[model samples]
Structures are given as C-alpha cells and as structure tokens.
Target: MTAEEFEKEAFALRPELKALASRWLGTPDDAEDMVQDAMLKLWAMCADLRSPIAPLARVLVRNICVDHMRRHHYTLSIDTTDVPDLSHGAADAECIDRMMAVVDSLPTAQQIVLRLRHIDGMSMADIAKLTGGTEVSVRKVLSRARKAVREQYLHKM
Candidate 1:
C-alpha cells in the first residue's frame, strides 16, 4: 500500500487499536503507549504492507499489548482482605469475600483465562495467541470459568 493509503487505514483503525490496547493494558496510560507504539511500527512498515490492514493492525496491537504486559509483569492481583461491615442493609461484603474465595479456589488456568477475558476485555483469538492455546480451547476455558464463577460465587450472592 502507498504511504497515504496506509496512513488513512491506520487512522481509520486508530480507535479500534486504542480500544484493544486499553483492554490488554488495563490502564489508560499504558493503553495509549501501546497504541502509539503499534502505530509507529505500522508507519515504519507502511511501504511494505501488501494485505488488508485492519487485521494486521489488530494483530500488531495485540502483540504489542501482550509484550508490554509480559515485560512489565502486569497481571491481576486478587485481594480478599478488608471485607466491609455491611450488616445494616448495606452491600453484601461477606458475599463479595465468598465470591473472591471461590474465584481464588479455581484452577490457575481458569483463573487466568477469566481475568484475561473479563478483566482485560480481550478477544478470544487474542487470548488464544497470548496463552498459546487454540481459539476453541480459549473459548471453552472462558466459558467453563464463567460458569464456575457464576455457579460457585455469584449464585450465592
């Protein structure tokens, strides 16, 4: 693609790229950085692009976001302490604690998949590549994890 065409395509997909980055990075600042880095790389290779740009842009954003998360050790840290005293018709603090405990009790794979899919808002394809699993496997794991979380935790609350 020509430089102008690549620029236009990149501009068109910038919002999507930012959204994907936001999902993977968790924080807005990190998401901005990921999007900027991905765009910079795409710009550098604009002259060599020979295929449709949207998927390539998404792939680039996903890879960069995963790399950033790995390099920075950005993983979810579940904290189950400090349950509030919701005795007088307030929110169910004890229920939240129970839910967290149930989530903690799940297998590591299930927990990771749940966090990456729900907490991080990543797509199944991206999660599959990130975890080195097949897309079907990722979907199954996510579905199982969600079911377990709902059945074991949210159902009680």
Candidate 2:
C-alpha cells in the first residue's frame, strides 16, 4: 500500500485503536501514545502491505498496546486511597472493585484479546492477524474470554 493509503486507513482506525489501547493501558494518554507508535510503525512499513490492510493495522495496534503495557509494568495493584468517595453509594464501589479483580484474573492473552476487540473496537479479522491466529479462533477466544468474565465477574454483581 501507498503511504497515502496507509495514512488514510490508519486514521480511519485510530478511534478503535485508541479504545483498545485505553483498555489495555488503563489510561487515555498511554492509549494515544501506543496508537501513534503503531501508526508510525505501519507507515514505515507501508511498502510491503497487502491489499486488505485493516487486519494488519489491528495487529500492529495490538502489538504496540501490549508493548506499552509491558514496558510500563502494569500490575493488579489496586490502591483506592486516591479515589474520593462518590455519592453513588457502596454498591457501585464494590462493583467496580469486583470488575477490576476479574480483569486482573484473566489470562494475559484473553485480556489482550478482549481489550483489543471490545475496548479497542477492532474487527475480529484484524485481531486474528495481529495475534497470529485464524479468524474463527480469534472469535472463539473472544467469546470464551467474554463468557469467563461475565460468568466469573459480572454475573455475580
């Protein structure tokens, strides 16, 4: 693909990429930075790109987000001291804590896939290529991951 085409497609997918990044990275700033880095990498490799670029872009974004998360050393530590008590009540707080715990419990691969597809808004085809899996496999992984999260975390709430 041409640089122009790559840029256009990357721009089109930016929002989705950012959303995925946000979920994986847990912050908007990190997500944007990861997406930018992914775009830069994609742009630099534009010459070798295939016709359908969406999957490639998604994979690139996923890789970048994972890299950022690893580099930053994000763990399951939940220090709630900084957060102020809200008027919404104790149930909301408990729910949030439970959800975080569930997210923390997920396997790394499932977490990454869930974030990229649900949070990042990436297409399954793109997720498959990014993760080096088939489309059907990616969908199955996502479905299983979602089911696990819902059953283990959300269902209890």
Candidate 3:
C-alpha cells in the first residue's frame, strides 16, 4: 500500500490503539504519541506489509507502549553521599570477597542468574529469556543464589 493509504488504514485503528496505550501508560498524550510513532513505522514498512493492517497496528502500538513502560520503569538508586559513613573499609572489602566466593559456590544456574541480574545488569525478563526459563523461575534462581550467599556470609560472621 501507498503511504497515504497506509496512514488512512492506520488512522482507522488509532482510537482503539490509543486507548490501549493510555490504559497501559496512564496518559493520553503518551498514548497518542505511541500511536503516532506506530503509524510512522507502519508507513515506512507499508509496502512490505502484506498482512492486514489493523491487527499489525494494534500489536505494534501495544509493543510500543510496553517498550515505553520498560524504558521508564522505576528502579531504586543508591547514593552513598547521602549515607553516613559507618567505617566501610577493609572489613567491607573482605565481606564482599566472601560473598563473591559464596556466589561462586552456588549451583551453576543460580550463579549465572545472579551474575546476569546484578553484574551484567540484565532485567529478569531478559535473563529468563536468555536462560530458557520463565520470569518466575529466574526469580527463584536469583533468590536461591542470594539466600545461599547470605547464609554463608552470616555463618562466616
């Protein structure tokens, strides 16, 4: 289809797609923006899209909303400058070394899961996909790894 025809077809599905995006993102403006972006992408790929446009548009807009959500996902930030120093020195380094050893002692899957989550800074969803497991399973592996390390650290102390 031509750019004009693609835009027209995409426009017909805009309200529905926009509402879906709004429900996910909790803002009409962002929802509209996502819909507009999906349209532009579809326009670029219009000639290549032989399938019906409505379902494609709906999936594209929803995926856009999900990507937006992921990009804006909240994460806890640590600022040591705001924390009172409690003499974190050689003792802390030793503790971190012990913890690393403990993590190394864990089962391979748990170790990989823990490293992927904290060291490589991958999201649980991503780790799960990489490890061929569900998100819950990945969480379980990470939890077990942490539990092992904590247990070893506590016992050492």
TM-scores for all candidates: the values are 0.50, 0.48, 0.47
Candidate 2 displacement at residue 79 in angstroms: 12
- What's model 1's TM-score? 0.50
Model 2 misplaced stretches (Cα beyond 4 Å) = 78-157
lDDT scores in order: 0.83, 0.81, 0.83
Which stretches of model 1 miss by more than 4 angstroms?
A: 79-157
Candidate order by decreasing TM-score? 1, 2, 3
Candidate 2, 39-85: lDDT as tens digits: 88877888998667778767887888777778878687887664445
- For residues 21-66, could you state the per-residue lDDT of candidate 3 as single tens digits? 8887888999999989988898888899764688888889889988
Q: Candidate 2 or 3, higher lDDT?
A: 3
Query: Clashes in each model (backbone N, CA, C under 3 Å)?
Result: 0, 2, 0
Off by over 4 Å in 3: 74-157
- What is the Cα root-mean-square deviation between model 2 and the actual structure? 13.6
Winner of 1 and 2 under TM-score: 1
Question: Number of the top candidate by TM-score?
Answer: 1
The candidate maximizing lDDT is 3
Winner by lDDT between candidate 2 and candidate 1? 1
